[model samples]
Target chain A: MAKMNLLQAINSALDLAMAKHDNVYSFGEDTGGFGGVFRATSGLTEKYGKHRNFNTPLVEQGIIGFANGLASQGSYAVAEIQFGDYIFPAFDQIVNETAKFRYRSGNEFNVGGLTIRTPYGGGIAGGHYHSQSPEAYFAHTPGIKIVTPRNPYEAKGLLLSAIFEKNPVLFMEPKRLYRASTGEVPEEEYTIPLGKADVVKEGNDITVLGWGAQMEVTEKAVEKAEEDGVSCEVIDLRTISPWDVETVTQSVLKTGRLVISQEAPITGGFASEIAATVQDKCFLYLESPIARVSGIDVPYPLCHEKEYMADHLKIYEAIKRSMNY
Target chain B: MAKDKKHNTEIVTKPKWFDKDSVTIPMLQILKEDGSFHKDADMPAYDKELIVKIHDTMQFIRILDERMIAAQRQGRISFYLASRGEEAASVASAAALDFGDMIMGQYREQGALAYRGFTVEQFMNQLFSNEKDLGKGRQMPVHYGCADLNFMTISSPLGTQIPQATGYAFGQKMDKTENCTICYFGEGAASEGDFHAALNMASVYKVPVIFFCRNNGYAISTPAQGEQYGGDGIAPRGIGYGMKTIRIDGNDAFAVLKATQEARRLAVEENEPVLIEAMSYRMSGHSTSDDPTGYRTREEEAEWQAKDPLDRLQKWMMNEGWLDKDHVEEHHAEVKAKVLAALKESEKVPVPHIDELINDVYDEPTDMLKEQLDELKDHMRKYPDTYSKTSGRLD
Candidate 1:
């Protein structure tokens, strides 16, 4: 095991995936020479030839379309879309082409080898465009996997799993944790099964579920909740889509309360999806209605993003409200 | 068939293969590295008065970039993007335009804004995100927008401004205004679909607009050569769209001035859209947060430094006897002091008031926005030390 930052773990994961699979090819906008703006694919171009890992024009739709075709032809394609906010341009390509490629072809052809990586969420002072958490938009789309990692350790494992899995995956890396979150990650090859949840801490009173950067917020708020004589179980739902409902339902069965948190708007966020599913599964067991703490339903504010974000304090308030109820 | 912008659209007796080489656009280079021009090359405007102002502004910008980069390192500012090597590309081109014309910039066109009389104090106010800032500290540092100057607010998303520029120019056309619009972007932006859409629409609609492509060698880390595009740099695409296209030496102030002046004439008088590809290099990293040593070599940077746009313009001005060497030295010192003074003042100012958070959501804050704002205010009050205004801390 090696202590690595989130970005380093991600880079190590990409390096291992490319090294193990000869057919693996990584390409995207500004991803060559210098390893992209974030340097996630830094040494890939030099180690693998430019033909395998290279840069594409600054067109999101074109990059994903080309990646879908490449992966369909039996090549393991890993594509990067500079930022998650910029991924909207390629929405139709992802929703219509990448997601439906398998079922539409009736097992004749599929882009199951495709993995699109993009940095997402706020806390970097990225202002309007750079700070959006776009997981909710992709989460609603069927047939594609949406996976996010809580920290460095999870980042390395989940990314590898996404790449090797026989399905198209949208791997959203938390930019806020790219360097801030560090942990002991195995240097050797390993894969964490997708659609599974990791129980960070076990308790009896209440269960708090969050993913990606929101995991930190949940843990911090849980700490505060524990201080207030409340026992809280924390769970990181790594795979957002086709999420690990079994683990979450079991946690809620033991702890009769639930709080879901996310950086996106609460109205239609992935957190809402979790809340809806958990309520149905633990109807009689649940002592109180599940609460969701998320961003306001508006475009992310720049200067007042601190006021706009779904921080630990908000989560703490939700935990208190649920505990009282 | 008649010859248009490109070589004879002649009928071919037999089909033959044609490569990208057949339509190569030669780069227009007028000034040499040492401030002297090529044998027959001359400055475009030849206006001695405007020349002095251009050189002064360039020197001020060069100094401002140097100081602000150091300031960012010292944590005096959040971020900074320098217009270092390509100052002349923005400044000289702006020198050729009328202030009435609109400018839509994709970040890193501070030279254009500086040329349009955006003061150092104004720049620092925006950088520091003080109450004095016109944007109310809403945008990131270097994302300056001045409606008064007709310079549209910068959009961070690449190439989004390309199609917007076309629509803006179309509006100007409908009003029958003599003014046109100029949009600035890098060659990497040319790869976006918006670039193609903008060019096609502008040509078909016959709007007056100038599409300036700063063909800097790198887009953050991606180089322009075989990576960004396989064909020749952005100029060839303009030809494909049936628009007037020219490639110029962005480092040479003279070439930029000449090309822009001519493009402006075409745009304003003939209602023609012109595309100019200025070949230069990003002498610095993409931003203060970036480290260029990772992707680019020291030798490559040294080579571009030798072709520094500011040095070439200063040399030409000195050679023409329009500027004195001693005065240039004192002027540099003066600009350095001026920028440092502005930095000091901007840093001392407080950030925009807390109410600014929910004010601009609409003309009047909606009931929901007001409720959210009240909740945030209550949270901040509950954890005063947790969320500080002076220092943005979530801990």
Candidate 2:
């Protein structure tokens, strides 16, 4: 086991996957010599050679389109978009071509061996163009798997699994936790199956569900709720689509109350899906309505960035309301 | 006007670097519209059997387009996109390529699919979206693909296949194979950003890909002349990207065949990208949904009709003494009958089973998908008369 940050763990995972398979390749802007802007792919080109790890032009559409073609022709491609906010340029390629390749061809063709990685979420003060969390947009798209890991352990396991899975996966890394979050990640080959949520803390007062950077805030809020004598259960939903509804429903059924937290805008956010599902499944045992603590419905602004973001205070307040009701 | 503060330059006489007006790339035409070989142009020596096969495929496609369009008008099929005016560009290009080479087409290359042995029955199954359709009724009519044929499925979005072809060719290059990829698009699709990106990447990586642009005169109702570009058509864009390029007469089968043959040699042998612009006209409406009278006149259509590719190929075949006029007429009648029979037979087949709707979304339907499918089936059971396919059967 090695104590590594999210960036180091991701780099290690890429090295392991490339060393294991000759057809696996990784590429993006500045991913070769510069080791990527965040250095998530640091030292890969030197270790695997340029053919297997290289850089591409600063065009997102071309990068994804090229990955689709490469994956279709029996190669494993790991393409990185510099940031989540910039992924819209490749949205059509992902949603239309990559997601529909298998269904559209009726099993004649599929780009199942492709994985697209991008840094997402706020706390880096990247303004509207850099910090936007667009996971909700892709959660609505079928066929492609969406995963966001909370720490180095989840990062390495989920990424390795995504590379080997027989379907396209959108792996969104919370840029805020790249260096802040550290954990003991096993160096051996490992994989955490997608659509499974981990129960970080067990309690019976209320269940708090979150993922990505919001998990840290939820953890702090759970601690605060414990101090107030309101026991809170915390769950990190690793995968967005095909989410672990069974685990969440089980937790909510036990607690009879739920608080969903996310950094995305409140309206039409992924939290709404969880809340609706929980309400439908655990309605008879509910002590109160599901509460959502999320970012306000506004573009992430440069000034007053904290006001636009969801933090521990807001999560604590929502937990108190759920417990009080 | 304000004068610059820091600069005084002399107007030294220097040779002009480029002139858009004089940089016209001439179109190659070996066989003229009059069915005679151009005296100065060299003829491509294809085997007599291959030539007959190409002509036969073209004849079949011509009949298929006519009957399908009429069917759409009669409301038998929902939609159709005909390859009416550019049959030579599509069929002759496919003829020059090896069967193993990949083909990525932009909708109107039905002739290429026909050339690669996609049968009339397969076409009917896809058109009717029947249970036997390979795509499982996912895509609309004319969006065809076959894994056995090495053809990527057609996408409706313009120019998306351009970069995809370049990347697929890169994969072929990595495999160190003698095969390459041919991407077909229209001149109008060239205006998209992906076109430039694909050409630049193909040139920079020196991948083996043939970017075949069918400059078929219009993008829907927009003509190619004043609105498409400010310079010579898509050929110069290829040259500007530092790749080999050729412009050819799309109505002349001999020119398209020879040009593509040479381009394929450069691509596969030298690991170089090549672009060929085939100048033709869309002899029909943009699609069954369009009407030519809205954007063009009958006289203009008549002018292009004089240069029909099918007529040129037939005249050349007759001149070679390989086919007689009576035999050509009889062949068309037989193909028409076969297509009609296939259409009727395919439409009678049932639509794909409801389970297919959620099956291919992943390797296997997840529990979530199964639940959703069950919910849908339950809803259908309640409102049986709303759906035609499931009205009688609930289980």
Candidate 3:
């Protein structure tokens, strides 16, 4: 095992997938010789040749549509949308075509082997365009899987699984954690099943749930609560759609309290879905009303981003309120 | 306005490199509307049997369009789109390609499907959305697809298929196969951003694709003259992309066939992308919901009706001693009768089973999907009388 950052783990996963499967290829704007804007695909062009790994024209729609076409013909396409903010131009392709390909064709045709990788979430001072958590938009769509990894080890395993999934997947990498979070990743290839939640810490007082960069915020909050003699169980929901409801519900049932955190706005965020599910499933075991610590419902501000972010203080406050109740 | 001294040193002069008004690419017309050929134009190498097959397919499509439009008027079907006047652009281009070549169509290319041997029965099943329909009633009528024929399903989005075609052809190139892809779109769809993106990618990559634009005068109700663009139609845009482009008389079957044949050769042999802008007209309303009279005069409709591709082909066949006027009328009547019979038979078939609604969402339905489907079935069972289709046996 070797300590690797999230970007290195992602590159290793692509290398492993392409080495094992000749049909696998990658394309996106600025993804070729320049690696990527984040260097998530560095040196893939030299190793695999341009036929498999190449830079595409700077058109998100074209990139996604081309990937869909390639996947329809029995090829595994791993496409990158440079940033999550620029993904709206390709929304029609993903929602109308990629998500609906199998359903409309009645299994006679499908683009099942497509993986779209994009870096998202705030906390990097990237301003509005470069720092958006658009996972909820894709989670609402059926026939597509959505996953967000918390650290490098999880990133490698989840990305490998997403590539092998027999349906389109939106693999959202938390850009803030690309280099900030490091963990020992396996030297050999491995996969962690999607839709599974990882319990970072187990306790009986209250349950704190989060994912992506928010997981780091959640850890700090849990540490602070522990200092005050508050025992909390922290969970990172590795996948959004087809989420591990059983894990969260089971933990909430044992803990008798719940606090959800996210970087997206509070209204209609992925946190809302988790809160609703936990409340519905663990209503009888409740000790407090379900609480959410999330960004305010506004555009991500540049200057006052710290105030806008769901920082550790907000998470800590939500945990204290839930524990008190 | 003041210019910087460094920039002011370079003088500005008008360059005559290209003319905006001039039609740089001439339209190829082997057969005129009156069945006369240009003396200098070489006839396409089409045999009598193939010519008759193309003619019959065009006539079948024309009759099918007329009958389906009437059916919509009588409230038999929900909607219909007629490829009324652009038969040559669809059938002849399809005739020019090999069976292995891929076809990614917009809405109005049923003639290509018919040319690829999509039967009258198959057409009716799709229109009626019966259990036998290949698409399993997932799409609206006329949104057709056939995997067996290498024809991608027709998506309702305007120009999404253009970029998809380029990518599919890139796959074909990677496989080193002799096949190429032909993508069909109207002049209106060409205005979409995907169209430009796809064309630029195809040219940059030198992918094997033939971009077939059916400039059928109007995109729904907007005329191609002032509303579409200020340039000389869509061919010059292809030239601007450094693609081998040609403009042809879409009503003349021979011209379309010849152009597509050459385009396919260039695409397969040289890994080059080609664009063919076929000039034609939409003789009918855009769809059953549209009334062309609201936008254009009946006189204009009549003018396009005179240039009907089927009529031009019929006249040419008659001049070549392949078909007479009475024979053509009898053939039309026979096609009408066959289509009417198929429509009646297809409508009697049951709708797709309710379980089909949840079948293809994934390789296998997840546990959650199965639970939801079961709940739906239970609800339908309790209200069986309200769900008419539930009376039939479900898979």
**Model 3, A96: alpha-carbon shift in Å?**
19
Of 1 and 3, the candidate ahead on TM-score is 1
Q: Which 10 consecutive residues of model 1 chain A have the lowest summed lDDT?
A: A297-306
Residues A117-231, model 2: lDDT tens digits = 9999997645555677899999999989999999999999999999999999999999999999999999988999988999998998899999999999999989999999988
Q: For candidate 3, what's the RMSD?
A: 19.8
Candidate 2, which CAPRI tier? incorrect
Question: What is model 1's DockQ versus the real complex?
Answer: 0.65
lDDT of 2 by residue, B1-395 (tens): 34454675334466546578666799999999988889999777698888888899999999999999999899888678999989999999999999999999999999999999999999999888777888776566788899999989886667889999999999999999899999999987787678999999999999999999999987775567654565788899998999999999998989999999999999999999999999999999888866777568899999999999989888988988988988899999999999999999998987776666666657888786576556556545654564557435546
TM-score of each: 0.95, 0.58, 0.58
| DockQ of each candidate relative to the true complex | 0.65, 0.02, 0.02
State which candidate has the highest lDDT: 1
Rank candidates by lDDT, best first.
Answer: 1, 2, 3
The 10 consecutive residues of candidate 3 chain B with the worst lDDT sum are B386-395
Q: Which wins on lDDT, candidate 2 or candidate 3? A: 2
TM-score of 3: 0.58
| Share of native C-alpha contacts between chains A and B (below 8 angstroms) recovered by candidate 1 | 0.62
* DockQ winner: 1
Q: A290, model 2: CA deviation in Å?
A: 10
